[model samples]
Target: MADQVKLHGNWLSPFSSRVIWALKLKGIPYEYVEENVADKSALLLHYNPVYKKIPVLVHSGKPICESMIILDYIDETWPENPLLPSDPFERATARFWIKFIEDKSPVLWGVFLADGEDDREKARKATLEVLQTLEERAFGDEKFFGGDEINMVDLAYGMLARWMPVIEEVVGVKLLDPDMFPRLHALAENFRQAAVIRDNLPDHDQMVPLFKIRREQLLQIAGK
Candidate 1:
């Protein structure tokens, strides 16, 4: 029998998208099982007993949890169209940016979920600062964080490119303005148009409405 590969993922999750992108880039044929995070399935729990999260990559019945870990595994397993750089120094640099984004991603989410004016403003500012630094330092004039083509680091930061606008609409704030963040905005647009990214991206039309509703629900709970 062919190697049975399955991915447990939600349609809207950027975390899940990470796994999807890796699989697609590697030309891996796998079954995608839509997982409802709210009322998670027993199978998901069985696979990822510790986290109980979506994006459990089940390869030959063994599960790999966590989006980044899954990406690393896919890269190592496939080796074709490599995502991480070959050079140790370059690989370390890519890992550094990936770690930075992972650590700071929560602060960006706070811009959507923050209740009070003070908190919202602070979160928004921090998020903007993060974007500015990334544009200046990471990409600069290169096509991607990895330079020339997309890589693991590029995929890691790709959410900001596509989802930030949807988030801006939902939150009623524009963080990645063309005037203020020209390079960042251009980079986002560039990534969105890339062949691999374009084909693999989530449906923004479907996501914007869901994110809007989710943001409103969160705001209500926070008494915004």
Candidate 2:
């Protein structure tokens, strides 16, 4: 197939999930190639030599690295289900929030990678700040960050909707409280129940055990 698309990604990765969401939303037919990050394959390394990472989208055999960048590429390639806003100001505003989440991503993930209790607490605090910012400043009265529909910003933040609770359950901390962050909480529910997003989320049961093992491995490596 000359127009064949292939995605090299892992189920455990939020980044990969975002790309998957974008592809499904756009109704693009593609082959999924699962990659184990622990032991990288020659194909994965060749596709993404700079990062040697997952979520690489191969369109017509040309590889595009980075999840966010791949989403943009998908949106551009298939303009039917537009991920970005058509209006210039709205698009700019959307991109602003997209950049915000990208920068603050480490803060949210730190909780999972933190070894000690104190470090985990600190990471939780930072994660709360990021979530609070999203709740307060990001989305106002919109059902989603994209206003009634899932946009690029939502795809960027959508990982938290499905995966955050699992992380909280595994790490034993509740940060995305309903009362504390009403808008974000509602958005999470709405996001999960949305069209493509609903059917394409990761399983909570499977993710919990995998994340636990990963956190333990990370802690041991860091401790050494």
Candidate 3:
């Protein structure tokens, strides 16, 4: 029997979107349950007891926590449109980049939550340095990080395509310049335009106000 699939996620969360895109790419039909991060549901807590976070994937009552791990689970279970490359070495490389981004993501978040000029500038510079490293070392000239098609690496970095632009607008700063990071810029554009990714992306206009409020809350908390 095919296992019933359900996804618990927050609409504004890029991490949730990562799992959504993976499921869509692999043609998996799953019911989506939206969660309120401010007041998380009991079911979400039950599914992810450790972190009690959103983006939990439940298949046949078995719960998978964390966005990337959920994607890997989806890929392993379905295995039709493979997210990671089949070659052992290539898959290892993809996993490396995925972990690399996961580790470095906080720098961009720091920029978003920055409350002062000095802090904002510091975060911006750190974010740019991370991007520069990816542009030169990670991506180089590949149309997609997984070569021509979207893969786990591309999905992992999907936040840059949608959320990053919104963040840049909200924060009143630009770190992804085409002139400086041409390859990365092109990758973002291509990633967004891909059929599954394009269809599933959240509306930018809708997200801006929510992000603005969240940014204020974050700053207020930090100030305290």
Candidate 4:
């Protein structure tokens, strides 16, 4: 029998999109099971028992959780599109940035979920610090973090392309300014325009309402 591959994901989730992009890039065929994150399914809970999150990849019955982990698994399993660099040192460097962004991503989400102006400002500042570091040190003059072509680092940072702008719009905050981080802005534009990314991205119009509702719900919980 053919290898059975399945993905549990939510359409609006950036984490889910990471796995989707990796699978699409590698030209792998899989079944996509959309999860209602507000009321997750028994299968999603079963597959990702620890996190109980979306974007879980089940390859022939074995489950892999976490978006970055799923991406790495897909890359290692497929080996066709080659997400990470072949060189050991280069791959290590890519992994470093992936981990860096993954660690700092909560800051951006905090900004999104901030209930007050003071909290939003603090979270935005923290997020900008992280982005500035990437702008100055990570990509440098290269077109991408991985240089020239999209790779694991690019996929890891894909949220900056599609989701960040929506967050900025919904929250009425401007973070990714062209004058402040020109290269990073350009990278976001370029990343969004990439074939796989462009085709697979969630609709911004549809996401705005969902994100707004989620932010309100989160803010209510925070206020409580």
**Cα lDDT for residue 204, candidate 4:** 87
Stretches > 4 Å off in candidate 4? none
Each prediction's number of clashing residue pairs: 0, 0, 0, 0
**Model 3 lDDT tens row, 22-127:** 9999888899999999999999998989999999998998999999999889888899989999999989989999999999989868789887899899999999
Task: Estimate, for each residue in 1-224, the C-alpha lDDT of model 1 and write its tens digit.
Answer: 24788999998888898888889888999999998877999999999999899889988888999999999999998899999989999899999999999998897787888777888899899988998787677755887666788889878888887788888877778898898888878777888888878888887888889998888887788676
Residue-level error in angstroms, candidate 2, position 38: 0.9
- Which run of 10 residues does model 1 get worst, by summed lDDT? 137-146
- My TM-score estimates for the predictions, one after another, are 0.94, 0.97, 0.97, 0.97
List the RMSD of every prediction in angstroms. 1.6, 1.1, 1.2, 1.2
Where is model 3 poorest over a 10-residue stretch in terms of lDDT?
139-148
Candidate number achieving the greatest lDDT relative to the actual structure: 3
Q: Any residue pairs clashing in model 1, and if so which?
A: none
Q: Report residue 201 deviation for candidate 1 (angstroms).
A: 1.6
Clashing pairs in 3: none
lDDT of 2 by residue, 1-28 (tens): 5789999999888899999999998888
Off by over 4 Å in 2: none
Residue runs of model 3 more than 4 Å from their true location after superposition: none
